[model samples]
Target: MSRDDRQARRGYHHGNLKQALVDATLELVVERGPQGFTMAEAARKAGVSAGAPYRHFKGREEIIEEAARQGFEMFADLMEHAYASAPPSALARFEATGRAYLAFARKFPGHYITMFESGLPIAQNSDLKRTTDRAFAVLTRAAEELIARMPKDKRPPASMVSNHIWAMSHGVVELFSRGQPGTKTPFAPEDLLESGIGIYLRGLGLIERDD
Candidate 1:
């Protein structure tokens, strides 16, 4: 190959090497907190020379931010899948989406924590912001559908109903992630979430309210 071609290939390799390094560092973040993570360790895990990460990332924080971006991208994908996989009914889809979100947080606590942290530079990424909104948009559509299906006599405004359901589900999942309805309690996480959503539906009069 020509010298210029070889140089371009080397640059591309360096870019990919840095991405792999950040990916490895995120895995470590799951096991070890961010404060305890290091660039050299990430390089070792990525199978690159110890100094290679410096070619792309300035420091440990830079790698963490990139990893956080990747995490949000995955989060958006999970939300999309949950919404797409639910049954025909809007309410059924809403519940499924809520459960899926909680499952994601429980399964990937590290990424969940990073993605939601306001101080993280990853939150500023345009793609992360866009993906985050797309995920919420899925929830919004489910809310609109549910509101549409409500009995003509009692249906709430779509905007109001959407906001209510979204808030209700997000609150339950966020609290559960913080360890609410602890294992010491009789109810499983799923049980608590199901019960909470039922109560919310009853309040909205979407389900028959027992007097």
Candidate 2:
């Protein structure tokens, strides 16, 4: 068969081709935009036969979706660690976890970008969505505790408060990761998240006097 014909077929050459293809595609996605990437190119990058990706990914969309899935899993693991190491208070855990979230984004810029691809069919991938939601739930739970302690008159719902804080951290991290160095905006990523969250806590009227 011609190289083009061989490339168009759906089947990989050997064991581990799936992982190899995924790895190659991730590098490609970082190098190239996610939309234009081709599975055949991933196979070539992996040093596998042109058709190798088919053994694992049904199509380019599947490859992209799975790559995104991997990103969410990495994020969830980091949040799990942050939640465990945080001090015994909702505010403490929220701050620490926000730091962890920023650290993860800074350290894994490629993976972090992939996780929030609204274009990808995340709803179809329930398991991956569930894992991502679990991480978000950690943040929401902390917000809920703070909200509950409020005198009801001044309290916002946990989900609303969590969304505000999450948007703050996520926007800052994303802008910083895009190489916006020290823009000195009112809310610098680090200061804004840690301190901004503290401000939110105070407004919520939930003070945990710690040593």
Candidate 1 lDDT over residue span 15-41, tens digit each: 677677766776777677777667778
Best by lDDT: 2
Please give me the total number of clashing residue pairs in predicted model 1: 0
Off by over 4 Å in 2: 1-15, 180-188, 202-211
Local distance difference test, candidate 2: 0.73
Task: Give the runs in model 1 whose Cα sits over 4 Å from its true position.
Answer: 1-16, 121-123, 149-184
lDDT tens per residue, model 2, 58-167: 88878777777887788878887888888888767777778888888777765665676437766678977787798888777777766776778878888888788878
TM-score (all chains, Cα) for each model: 0.72, 0.80
